[model samples]
Target: MADEKPDFEVPVGLFEDFEDLKAQVARLTAQLQTLTEGAGEEADEASADDVTAGAEEADRGDAPEDEWQYPPFILLLDPPQYDDELRALTEWVEGVLVPGYLAEPSSDARWCHLWFEHPVAVARLHALWLAWQELTDPASCGYTGPSVWHRDHLDPSMRELRGSSGPFAGCTKGEHQIDHRIPGLVPSAWRQNDA
Candidate 1:
């Protein structure tokens, strides 16, 4: 019988109601999409022929000389000249590692694609460094020596290689996997020689 009789009334306005705000946002988004779609309607209809012609031009590899000049990311092909460690590493990659790796027929495609993906060719260079480090580092060199592969070496390579001017060029029907790097390589190659 201790104070079990009466309790205070619960507050009515505890939670913030955002239904009006949410409705406004939904209406605005719909309006924006409609506006943008309307704006592009004419361009979309008129560009069909132009788009096809442009694609044909691109197919001929006559897009434009300037087009070959890649974005800032592509300039990383060569490592920065300032950092000694990176510079040495890059040089080693270009001069030593890639050449050795490419000598193997099986890995040629894998490494090539890896080189293409490097905004600055860092992947291939790093792969080489990792290979070298494998020779030096005692712990996990052979086990996980940088597993970078060239971009053009994988199934994408197969697509491009087949796509440009071959029987499979337009045949987009097939099971293809993007082989980013050498898959299923044994860890022993990455280990230090002595280790």
Candidate 2:
């Protein structure tokens, strides 16, 4: 095994070039750190009005880098960087999401088109979709795939979306009928109760 040839080949002079680039990066990083530290000290001397003005920029959409509107998993909005992201999400929703949720009519979960517009629903859906994609991917061999899908993604999202104390609490109140009901959707029995 010791005499076996390695799979990769490295150019003779590439090592020195890598070392040179590494040193340059370290030097530039140190310079940037010093500049930022100095700028922070100057910022502390600003008047109260100036600090308040800076905060207004955040509300005005001028400072969104640190205050992005959507989570990182949301690839469809904020200018729609990934073109295929929406397509993939749509396909999954149509193919898996609808059927899975509707399979159990008694499950508290039902299809609501307006959920696409709700902020909380959109965020959790995007997270769950991303995790489902990763776990089903052929190249994803990590042990964390299923764990993340169930623990970090699905459980919390479902709890937030359909738990008794969740957003749908009032929507699902006393509406058990061996069938799912959309949030805020009134069935005939609901009207009868008011009589």
Candidate 3:
């Protein structure tokens, strides 16, 4: 028995796919490291000529107008950009926020499965995500970053989002309220005059 070798079979395509995924991960990791290292250095080291040249290129439309800027607000983004951002937000919400903090659901602490459908909820969650990113970054927010995030950003946002009277008021732990509606505001006299 000791002399006999155990027989196991692995699929050829699975090995190739695994190798491809590893290579992609390596490339992405290198790119992320480069960007992280350059972020502050590039800003500080840029000469006036570099700035002027960049501005000139932008004016000439050589730079793409839709080039992403950091810390983008979800509501202000174009449809394509918004869709990309929403995907990322959904990932964070489902992966981190829900699993870590909001797993339990109750009458007092409600959560909507279709949270992204609610504009106000989306905006608030986006803001909370932005704050979480900044506050949890050690270089940006220091040693107390996580603590600050929980105390200042997380707690309030969660309370508001999960409150009984909040945006998820119509939703419940077990069900999503498809027909949930925001109350209509009274029309302004000036706007009514235009009609």
Q: Evaluated with TM-score, which candidate comes out highest?
A: 3
Tens-digit lDDT track for model 3 on 1-195?
Answer: 899988999887676556556656775787798678768585768999988999998798575455544677898777899999999999999899998999577888888889998877999999989988877765444446677789998899989998987888888767777466646886654334433
Clash totals for all candidate models: 19, 0, 0
Greater TM-score among 2 and 3 belongs to 3
Q: Relative to the unseen true structure, what is the C-alpha lDDT of residue 124 in candidate 1, on a scale of 0 to 100? A: 31
lDDT of every predicted structure (CA atoms): 0.43, 0.59, 0.80
What lDDT does model 3 reach? 0.80
Model 3: clashing residue pairs?
A: none
TM-score each candidate.
Answer: 0.22, 0.39, 0.60
Q: For residues 7-109, could you state the per-residue lDDT of candidate 2 as single tens digits?
A: 9989855864565566567757877987798687876688999788878986785854633353355633544543355556667776887776534423466
Native-structure RMSD, model 2: 12.8
Say which candidate scores most in lDDT: 3
Q: Which digits, one per residue and each the tens of the lDDT, describe model 1 over residues 80-188?
A: 5325545566677567655654443232222332333332245334443444544343232222222222332322333333333422222232322343344485656
The Cα error of candidate 1 at residue 179, in Å, is 22
